[model samples]
Target: MEQQSLWEATANERKERQALQGEQHCDVVVIGGGFSGLSTAYHLQRKNCQTIILEKESVGFGASGRNGGEVLTGYIGSMELHAKKKGLEAARQMWQLSLDSIDLIEHIINTHQISCAFRRNGDFHAAYKPSHLDGMKREQEVMERDFDYKKIKVVEKQDLHSELNTPFYHGGRVDESSAHFHPLNYALGLAEAVEEMGGTIYEQSEALSYRKESGKVVVNTNKGRVIAKELVIVTNAYSGDFQKTIKKTIVPVESIMIATEPLSEELCQDLIKHDRAVSDTKNLLYYFRLTADHRLAFGGSGRSSSKRDQENLFNNLRAGMITVFPQLKNAQVDYRWGGKVGFTQEMLPYMGQLEDGSYYAFGFAGHGAAMSSMAGKLIAKNILHEGGGDNPLEKARLRPIPFHSQHAKAVGMMKFYMKFRDRIS
Candidate 1:
């Protein structure tokens, strides 16, 4: 099996760019070249701003390329929970922003003419238990009545077989606004668009540190230095100790995925009749979708330990796939890979300027494809003195994870807790 992302394997030719070799200056410097950073640069360049992107690796080498490519519509948590934590109006705004994020993805694809196999085929939030279906119904009602959103259709258990050819799911809900696409292609296309608009991108240019000097932020890198009026941190899960506080704010969880060899057209049609992306209601949930090339791309939250045995990981994921689609028990796994996802204590993403005047947006948990792209544009608008501060996430207090000092132990405990919760629920 290829030890690479299916998206990367199928992507078009990638544009090569030189690394930062000397001192540079720009209006803003974006660290990381994933969706958030690239999208931020794209928007800023369109506004005629001088922007510089510093990536430790090639553009889209991080979660931007490694994700499941589900363009979902909502935060990690439910709208009801958000409303209780914040207010009803605030939750409504957040939901509206999520819907807007989906629109932004479509806009970027169309304006850039990105041939990333973008599709609005919708998504299935499958229920593992009867209670999960009840929750879906309640959520759908709340969304329709309170937020005036009605794209979701609740599928009863009796009608579940018509939507999915699996008895594993009790029922589910369908959100037609959601989409799936080739993630790497879209990221590369965004990079091309950024360069076309006069933005500078430097690969293998890892940012070492940053400090304010003469009313400007000077970023020290491995190969060069960058001085800019503002800075944005878009590293997300790959964020190491670049900023100590930011690192503590999120727990990086490993997500593993495997893509099966192209199945027969009849089998693919039988597997997912509507070609809709699917995710189940479980603590360590399984998400699967029919790739543009007719392969089954299945993924899930892996073990807490980072040093996972590849063979074991593949076996576990294959078993999960077989549980959902028994016919896939003998299918050959073509690709197996893993990536990290940043999860916040609140289980939602946050975006705003930091105390040091450096902007940041991270902690998407597992739902980031659309949100990160939208965050990039919003961050750019905020830097331009536009009305981008209205986002409710800006008001959230960034809290570090409990027992973060004992990282490994804490994560192990978290994994145990989740497993226990899943068992009881």
Candidate 2:
């Protein structure tokens, strides 16, 4: 079976951009052509900043296009824990920012008329165990009492049938503010918008290294170089050795996804009743949603980085899907793909200027679709002197993770521990 991304296979055709040639000068140079870079270029160009985007591959070839298409509107970790660590006031601000991220995506799609099958159908956080439902109840209460946010509704085990036809979950919580979309198409649309607004993008042009020269930053690629007043590194998981400091601060993990052949409309409705994206409460969570063509797109933690592991990942995802919805027992998987996700020590996203005087953002965990786009806008504001520095995310520093070279082994051990705990609990 061939491994590919459903998003890439279905995404609209985009005009090919030639690799950078000779030398070019711009007000800002954004590295990586994923959501963050494209978004930063779009926002900067709208403000008449001479911006150029350098992409190693075609646009959206990285995590931005290969993600699970979940436009979630909150933290992946516990909200109450976040409130306890950072004062309630700080937590409140972060919560609002999360909501604003989703809003920005909707605004961009509407403003640029992006045809990415965008939908605000919300999402469901399922309880893998009976005790998990109790935690969800507390989360709902905390959001209402402390954050003044009450959009979440908890479904009891008895009432869970209305949401999903699965006995694997005991209950779940629904967040009406969350959404889903065709991520690759969205990224392509932003690329087009950036060009329309006078920003130039070069495909197959990777930033090999960069250095500060005088007051400007000089980025070098194999074919050419860019000299700009400012540089933004949005490479995230693909930042391999390009910047040692930033690379040390991030742990890149792989995530695998599979898309099943299109099911009958009736079967799709039976599987995901309300057509909302669904994720389970587990250390290695199971997230799945219905595609526009009625196919089930399922994803989970990937075990290894080896290309030979693709078959293993596909089997794992298919088994997980069948466990949740036995009706798909014989469903044929049409596509299988994997992408890297950046995780920080804090397990939260961060954005700020590095010691090298370059702006950067990464460690979105799995929330890049919404958070990364917001990071782009914030980075643009920082460049334009628009008070973006006031945000909490901008104040945090990306500290290097100790023993960074052993990330794969460490992640494997952690996954083993988490899986054991999940089984016992």
Candidate 3:
């Protein structure tokens, strides 16, 4: 399989924007150009904020471009967990925002005329084990009783074949509100809209460092610098050395994906009749969907960042894909790629002001596609001093993960434990 991602290979191209050169100034300086950064800039531009976006690479060069295009609903973990930890009201608010995030994506697509092949045909949460259906039942009940969400429809084991061609799942739950699309295309379209609204985006410019002085935050790049009233860091998994504190709050976990060569329309239909994005229940889950070109895009979790390990992971993903759909045993894989996703202890995205008074957002777990957009909007609202006192994600402070320096080892251990549990259960 080619190392390139299917999204990268199939996305529409856009002209490269110039990197930061000489000193510049804006009302807000966004430190990343992925979904969160571009979404923040896009919303800020609507408020007529003089925003400048600095990207180390092209837009969507990070997880925004590399993710499986599953625009799923709710936080990464279950709503019951959120309620148990954050209280029921807070959980309800977060639940509503999760739903709103999907709507926001649809609104942006329609308003901006983004041709990302978006579909709202819904998504399915397949029960990888028969016992997994009990958890799905609890989730469905919580959504109805507490969250007031009624979109989930549970399918029994005998009827599972109607929803999925696989014999792997015992049952499944379908959420008609969830959707999927071309993630890279959506990011590119958002970047275009940001530029159209007079927002400046520097493609190759990286935010090396930033300091607050004289009521302004000065962000310095390799070639230039940006001075602004506020700064927003939406770097996600690429936070790196920019801000060690923010980096420590989340662990970057490896996730890999493969796309099969375009199949016959008849075959595609047979593989997934309803064409809803599907994911199985597991700590290390396999999520997949059909691309607009009729290729099955299958992806799953991984533990290593090395190129050799990535090749192995790709092979493992192919095996997993074939396990789900035996007909794909001989199908050719066209593309294979992997990237790190920011995983937080809470399994939820967080957006708030740092101790330095600069605003930030990250740790979307696996919900970055839609939650990151909501993160952007919330960050913009907070920056503009708009009303957002009710959103739980917008906190007054962020806490560093305990023993974060060893997070790589910790994540590996956790993945092993989860895998063992999956095997036994």
Candidate 4:
């Protein structure tokens, strides 16, 4: 399969659109033209709602453009976490939703005929330490019994090391229903599909302000404004000052990644028997996978919600990658990039209507890509009142931490605590 390099995959495949110049009118205004915004606008336009997507930068410029490209259901749901909030039965449905998100992503690729190296091989979550394996085991037991999720299977040290070609992993949990692909390509493809469906996309038209007048919300960009009956905030962590309420509601986490020069076919095949992405079990972990070109794109993105020193986040992440995949100690790093991910205190993705026609969907916890794309559809469904496609999560509320200080000290303290924990271990 011949394709452009992973970093540049979406370059040639993007659907270019003119930026918003002057005042414009659209039925719905979608902020942030990434996966969440693009998919939402695409689906909304398909429903014949005259829609316009307002992109802060180019489409796929944020996390949608930069992510581990790992599609898996082990992130399906946490029984422990869900049980604490919504109980066991609701958690079971949450598990199904995670699995459904995986299926929905693949379905979009097939139905839209998007050529983003879409594959259904599977994904592996490996253990960085012995304790991590226990967490994996707990995950396996509850998911299998509660949701009848048989797609997940465990691989012991011997089998995992052989398949992963990494000595640091103790074992791994494999999910058959998940896969990986070029994320930016997928996001750009979704935007293209939206245009094909007669939707208008306005790039570089950052939403700087919004005024809710009457039933219409006027979205003001630098050069233009859209008076939309409904508005969707799909910007995630990049929402910026367009909406102070949204900006204050969530925290942005910095994620870093790197791409390596192409490897020998034999070496690539030896590294991963099949074509699935792998992430380890660490608070800050290493995620990597083989591309269609036989090169390895490993993720070592460190997160900083509030601004902090980023002088050497890449170098630290690369060092972490070598620690996990020591075999790649000498691999030539080709591209290093970073982006932000929004997270809510609840750890569940915040999805709900802010008002009658205004929707908020961000905070996909730590996993977005496919899940964020799924969220876009949900936003469209709620706006269109097509309740069938709207699931139980349509009404999920935001649970903010009582004391989420933005001084950046909160994360710094967490980092200090983690370092101490590691030292103790």
Candidate 5:
């Protein structure tokens, strides 16, 4: 059987193949051409820096292309928790950084004129009971009073009738600034712009090994190898399988998604009066949104098994969607699939240089859409400093989860337990 790929699901779009078959060298060689790799290449080319992007498959073939396409506006870290860990000052900076990710993403999209099925409406945090609403209200109050989360507003159950098609939840919080788009298209758009800016991207160029020797990193690939003064490994979950160090940092978690056939304008409006995206307040998150063509695109984290193909390409998430919006019982599904998302033992991302002049970026967790993109830009900025500063890639100061060793089983257990709670909660 033909192994399935995320890129294969998109419209008949195939990136050009590399015809050259000789060894090559560059100033910087980026392995893994997903969002992080593409974004890093984009920024590097814009800075007039010499760089190349190597992908095991096509551009955006990883989670970047296959994500549920949510443009969330905040970090995965809870504000209250951050305040405790780093105090109010550092927590504020962390919160603001997340908001800035929104602006930076839009700026890139606009400057490049990428047709990515983009939108600007926000996402929602829906609740299933009054107690859930009350807890959300408290969270909202605290966030507004301390962090200026003014975009979040309380939604009552009565007001939900016209907004959502599901009858499951009582109320929720609506954030009017979060957006959703075609993730694959956006990733591709970035890839094209990066190449146009004079960056080299090699598809089917798989990195097999790398090593730091004599003050330079020699990277081995399937076709040929490139020795670079600086090396970046952005493979995320799909690391070369050659680097034990990188592999130990992130454990892959698969997320399932389903797409419904385009509905009539009237039917679409029945669910999203403002065309917003939604996510329920559960550990095993359920997220859904309206496509530009009036279809329902939904996804949720956590899976039934470890084998990527064993759980099946996609299981029916519609029953859960129905619980949220009962009006879609007969909705026609056009696609059903899932892809792997990597997370560290801690939910936070792991970025910055491991000692010895090599850069490592991975574990954006579930919020890779913005975090990965921002991380790449930060990596480029750090590379720019001819003199590495005291705070190279300031974002890296956040220490990685101490229990990186427990990431694999911990994440799987977390998902399994969370799903159990979600079904009952």
Candidate 6:
């Protein structure tokens, strides 16, 4: 019951990689060392490209390491809504891409021989209110008719007890294509694969600035400068001011999680009979799943952002756990952690080159485990001129959020809206 991530605690010790030293050069320089960056570097290395990855901290130190590890299919927003707005054919392609993203994860795990306890146990989208079932029904129908997808099945309130031993949910949908895994281990495995393929990764080396000079992209870091013919930015929610324009196009929201001490096997079986990852239908959602060692990893968002207020945040999360399963009221909490997720106005991820010709991909909302990996591969394909097809996100215009300087205030307002919506709906 350590005060750290269960994945980090159990993962194998990572060997240190050297940081960038004065004035190095490569064919491509990637900024950030999370899933997106590591995946991109791995694929690029496979194509015989000389690539180098720069990380502000160790690999996977950002959301990639801290996530709940639910590798789910599809984007954050409603597929039905996307179909209506962007046409059925377009929506179907996007849906297929999401499924392909899941396939990509399995391929990486199998190909790289990664031992991250990858499991395709499926995912449950529980309805917080009865009205939410109607949308699930519509989504299922759309997936079947328009996309020819049939892995998802609607679970009635009566049948939900068999899938999950919870009285809080009215009904839900289960998709068998989704999965859970040790996210940190997966990222580390990719880092190892990248190095094995002759690519270099520099930890603790933050990219400070980048400029085009003499037909090359010169990126300055705290340790050294990297000159390359191409550059890729995969910072996601940790973008900070590194790329000012891209940062403005996304909103970083804090997502907090807490893990309980290992429950008895019988209790774990009773809590989630099918061992599926679960997420409720609320603007401020709660997602949970059982870890490999049988710990209940529960997480959600809260209003406060202060680190000093963690005790209150932990209490709030514990109350949420009890609300979902009162049997866990006496369970001892083990770990408490939080990370930021980037959300776009459309609630979908964006990928493409910037006005300066540098490639970039981000804004996956909270459904990034699969999407981020797919995005990295796609970005590399685009860079190599391998014809990865036209990415819809690339067509999206990067629009800055209004009053971007008041992000904290905006998040406060969003919390209020979510609470009101949860109450009325």
lDDT against true structure, model 5: 0.73
Q: Give the distance in Å from residue 326's predicted Cα in candidate 4 to where it truly belongs.
A: 2.8
Residue by residue across 1-425, what tens digits does model 6's lDDT show?
Answer: 11477677878679788888898889999999999999999999999999999999899988899889999988765777678878987887888888888899999999989988899989999998888887788889978887888999999999988888988998899999999998999999989999999999999899999999988999998878999999999999889778888888777777888999999999999998888888888778899999889999999985464655777877988999999999999999888877878776666888988888888888887789879999999899999998457566564357676654746535744665475445434
Which window of ten consecutive residues has the lowest lDDT sum in model 4? 1-10
TM-score per prediction, in order, is: 0.95, 0.96, 0.96, 0.90, 0.89, 0.95
The residue-by-residue lDDT of candidate 1 on 54-164, one tens digit each, is 999899998999999988988765787789889999998899898899899999999989999899999999999999888889889988998898899999999987678
Minimal lDDT window, size 10, model 3: 416-425
* Cα-based lDDT at residue 181, candidate 6: 91
Q: Estimate candidate 4's alpha-carbon lDDT, on a 0 to 1 scale.
A: 0.74
Candidates 5 and 6: which is better by lDDT? 6
Question: Model 4 shows how many backbone clashes?
Answer: 4
Model 3, position 295: C-alpha lDDT score: 99
**Candidate 1 segments whose C-alpha is farther than 4 A from its true place:** 304-308, 409-425
Question: How should the candidates be ordered by lDDT, best one leading?
Answer: 2, 1, 3, 6, 4, 5
Cα lDDT, all candidates: 0.87, 0.87, 0.86, 0.74, 0.73, 0.86
Model 2 alpha-carbon miss at residue 219, Å: 0.7
Task: Please give, for residues 236-355, the per-residue lDDT of candidate 5 as tens digits.
Answer: 877647666667666777677777887999988888777887777666678888887788887776455456543443544677777666788888777777777876655566777766
- So what's the TM-score on candidate 5? 0.89
For candidate 6, give the lDDT of residue 293.
Answer: 93
Error of 5 at 91 (Å): 1.5
lDDT of 1: 0.87
Identify the runs in model 4 with alpha carbons over 4 angstroms from their true place.
1-6, 74-77, 303-311, 355-357, 388-390, 394-425
Clashing residue pairs in candidate 1 (N, C-alpha, C atoms within 3 angstroms): none
Cα lDDT tens digits, model 2, 1-425, are: 22579998898988889999999999999998999999999999999999999999889988999999999978756678788888888889889989999999999999999999998999999999889888889889999999999899999999999999998999999999999999999999999999999999999998999999999999999989999999999999888778888888777787889999999999999999998988888778899999998999999888564656667777877998899999999999898888888876676887888887799998888889889999899899999999544577774556677663656534854565365435433
lDDT of 4 by residue, 337-367 (tens): 6777676655557788764447888877557
